[model samples]
Target: MKVMGFAGWSGSGKTTLVEQVISVLTARGYAVSLVKHAHHSFDIDHAGKDSWRHRQAGCREVMVSSGQRWSLTRELRGAPEATLDELLDKLGPCDVVLVEGFKRAEIPKIEVHRAVVTEPLLFPEDGRIVAVATDTEVSTTLPTLDINDPEAVADFVVGYLAL
Candidate 1:
């Protein structure tokens, strides 16, 4: 699969741009998958749900299936956080994998930036950053696209990956 990442500081619109790109990409007949990394703890199951109950009862992994879809939640517990490659191994094949966060990983990435974020550009320090999607005008050798132009960004990503 072609792997691309979206990296930026908090409130920089990475998630929004990724969501838009996914919609455009999917509409264009490409199968896309997303993998997001969260710094803080998060929950995908509610307290009263069977999956939640199974997890609370000390099940290492719980797979909940229905006719349309299924989700597998695994508890890492004290185990070290899994690497990007390890996480990707668990995902089924797709034409592209749009990863959010995992900024330190050595993969091609599009940095979503906003002037209001007031943060230094990740591309300056990270050679893996291939392009940027921003709200403000930027002058750089790499392509700079409008953050709202999801179709343009999606086109760039697809072209870059030759997908």
Candidate 2:
């Protein structure tokens, strides 16, 4: 499956832009999946939930399912964090996989940027950042996309991927 990523600093609205692109891509009949890298610990299950209870009881993996949908939560315990390629391997296959982080990964990516953020632009230092999506104007030789315009961004990605 083709893979792309949205790399940016905190508060740069990477998540929001990814969401929009997902909507646009899916609407166009593409089977898209996303893998987001969180810098901090996160929780998908809450207290009193069966999945949470199973996890609390030390289950290695807790899969909760119903007629509507299901989720499989695996506890890494003390295992080393999986690499980006390893995570991608677990996704089976699809038209595209929108990765929301892993800025250093050697995959093509769109750098979501907000000039207001203090961090410098990533494309300069990261060769994988082949495109830039931003709200304000920025000068760059690479293709520039409208971070606020999902359709335009989607169009660029689709065209780039020739999908």
Candidate 3:
């Protein structure tokens, strides 16, 4: 499977662009999977839920299944977080994997930038950044894409990966 990433500071519209790109790619008949890296502690299970209770009871992992969908949640239990490669190995087969973070990863990535954010651009230091998607013009030799146009971004990804 092919892999690509979107890296940006918070509120830079990375998630929104990724979400729209997923819709575009899937609509084009490609199976797409995503791996999002959360900087803070987060939980998919809610308090008092059966699955949550299972985790609270020290279960290493819990699987929740329903007619519509199923999910497996594993507690790291203080172990180091898994790396991008390890997480990729856990995903089912897909045409492409759209990663939401892991900015330092060496994989090909698109730097999402918003002029309003005070944070400096990442492409300057990140050799992995293949292009930039921004709401405003920026000074860069890399290909600049309109952040609001996910279709264009999707096209760029397809061409870049030759998928």
Which candidate has the highest lDDT of all?
3
Residue by residue across 72-162, what tens digits does model 3's lDDT show? 9999999999999999999999999999999999899999999888899999999999999999989999999999999999999999999
Best by TM-score: 3
Q: What tens digits encode model 1's per-residue C-alpha lDDT throughout 88-153?
A: 988898999999999999889999999999878889889999999998987789999889899999
TM-score of each: 0.97, 0.96, 0.98
Candidate 2 positional error at 44, Å:
0.7
Which candidate, 2 or 3, would have the higher lDDT against the true structure?
Answer: 3
Tell me which of candidates 1 and 2 scores higher on TM-score: 1
> What are the runs in model 2 whose C-alpha is more than 4 Å off?
none
C-alpha positional error of residue 31 in candidate 2 after TM-score superposition, expressed in Å? 0.8
Higher lDDT: candidate 1 or 2? 1
Ranking, lDDT, top scorer first: 3, 1, 2
Ranking of models by TM-score: 3, 1, 2
Q: Candidate 2, TM-score vs. the true structure?
A: 0.96
**Cα deviation in Å at residue 69, candidate 1?**
0.7
